[model samples]
Target: MLTYVRWYWPNDDLWNYEELDADRWALRHVELRGSDGVFLAAASLAEVLTARDSGTVGAVAEYERRYGVVPEAPLPPPTDALEPALESVSPGEFERLWRDARRQLEQQTGI
Candidate 1:
């Protein structure tokens, strides 16, 4: 599968500076490729208007009830010796790490 660039943004109605602190806001976006990458899909959200028209009222109900309460992203990984160990790094540096790690893995497997 191709990698994607997903990001977060505010949804306004549910979130604002008053509701959330200075560091926070409402919705987050997880963009995915569709229709030759022109059209985008968010992994966390379904198409509300389309779902309503499709007679998926149950889906809409579920969405309304569970949208903000549950996070679509994976829970934070537990710290352990075997894990990759994440940290904050710039994109350029991160890419370099990915390249180096790929080389190491390939070397180990003789790929």
Candidate 2:
């Protein structure tokens, strides 16, 4: 068997949950395991980072250091019922979606 990895991009300062407006995402080999004939996922960090909201990964991670937790993050907003990619989504709709996801996370996590 093999372990897997997941990467995420979070909006806000990645510091304060209060700053967590929660928009952004990306995929990376944040983790991994050795194995064969199973599954594999790989991509350039730049490519993955591009999906991220708008911060350099280092900055975001640094912010998390003092906060004790990364900002709340969910998937990017959908453009419409037919489209769910950020490239397709309107700016306003994306903002709303980010806020909504954060609101939901706050309610559930109580953070």
Candidate 3:
């Protein structure tokens, strides 16, 4: 099982974090959206948290390349009223939700 959490930045940007497990709290997937609620990028939590250049272009860079502007950086782990409680979910359920989100984004953006 895994845990999913969401946070809203002050700028109205959103962050989705998937944890390894409910008890562990180690991050897995991290997704980012713009203030306009556009899907900007998705990457491993390590990638976003560490800001490490893995020598390969990441989703964030690709998004910037396609849109011609860099999206806002992932803010530090939310510790205020911005964060909501973690929701536990099975791995398969998480995958389904992720796929659905991608499909919806594609339909909305036509990309």
Candidate 4:
């Protein structure tokens, strides 16, 4: 199962770190999302920790220093009534849906 870790700092800053596995910790496919829930960056664990990028490195360091570890339990599900439970989907269906959503988003934002 996918694992998610989150950190909320001062000034309403927040970040979501996602990894495919935690047991054999690695960041090969890790994803980082910004406070606004926008995709920020994807990098290996080593690179993120050792890179000179202050913002990203600082965030990670603060999270680890305060939290004591990485890849903690997944955040609780949204409490909104409209939120749906997790569901499984076939790869083909997922790809189609993802593509459609991307197309719609690009059309709306002209990105």
Candidate 5:
């Protein structure tokens, strides 16, 4: 089966898309292309779908949402050993951290 999504590319303020082919339970492949039908990259199907579902826009928002924003100063890694604990961080805490990290980034980069 094949599916297509109309994707919005904020960089050039243009519309682009991905051609997804599903075979049985998993995706076959994903093709990323520009509005003009030029090939951009061959990306992972799951990764592409996740971004599409997450409504990601812009470089910073995409990175910050997919991966936590980088801190200005080096910070120690958590000492905890459980994966579930990390997943259980409260939504409020997550928002606060993102906001603080973004603010710090803007200050450092003067964006």
Candidate 6:
């Protein structure tokens, strides 16, 4: 199953989406898809998430070095829904959903 996440920059017209593998709860792809569903640039999810988890400062530096410009806005937290994610959600709602998902996944995988 594929879980889609939409991210909008602070002042940018175009948005990006992260397509994750729901079974493994891992990222699979990232891209800026048009309304007609045309894909723009794509990149490895593991690579991007790894960079993000490392540290914001380091990630910004790496992005700037590679893309020539760092992302000015951070990704907004996901909503509290149990299924498909939303574009905007409260932090509290996101935390609740995250904790539940983590617990359930851990129980199922015993990891």
Best by lDDT: 3
- lDDT order, best first, reads 3, 6, 4, 5, 1, 2
Off by over 4 Å in 4: 1-84
Indicate the residue-level lDDT of 21 in model 5: 38
Local accuracy of candidate 5 as per-residue lDDT tens digits, 55-88: 5566445544433322222211236353111122
Model 2 has an lDDT value of: 0.31
Give the C-alpha miss distance for residue 17 in model 1, angstroms.
30
TM-score of 3: 0.38
RMSD (Cα, Å) for all candidates, in order, is 16.5, 16.1, 6.6, 10.8, 18.6, 13.8
Of candidate 4, the 10-residue stretch with the lowest lDDT total is 24-33
TM-score of 5: 0.27
Q: Write the per-residue lDDT of candidate 2 for residues 1-111, one digit (tens) a residue.
A: 211212222431111111112343332221112232111222223443443556665654432331223223443344445422222334454344335444544454466
TM-score of 2: 0.26
**Would you estimate the TM-scores of all the predictions?**
0.26, 0.26, 0.38, 0.29, 0.27, 0.30
Q: How much is the lDDT of residue 66 in candidate 2?
A: 19
Q: Write the per-residue lDDT of candidate 6 for residues 1-111, one digit (tens) a residue.
A: 655555543344444544445442434323333454333333444556667788676884553333222223333335434333345434454344444434543454455
lDDT (C-alpha, whole model) for all candidates? 0.32, 0.31, 0.49, 0.40, 0.37, 0.43
Evaluated at residue 32, the lDDT of candidate 3 is 51
- Off by more than 4 A, model 6: 23-26, 29-40, 46-77, 80-111
Clashing pairs for predicted structure model 5, backbone only? none
Error of 3 at 14 (Å): 8.2
- The local distance difference test score of model 4 is 0.40
Scored by lDDT, model 5 comes in at 0.37
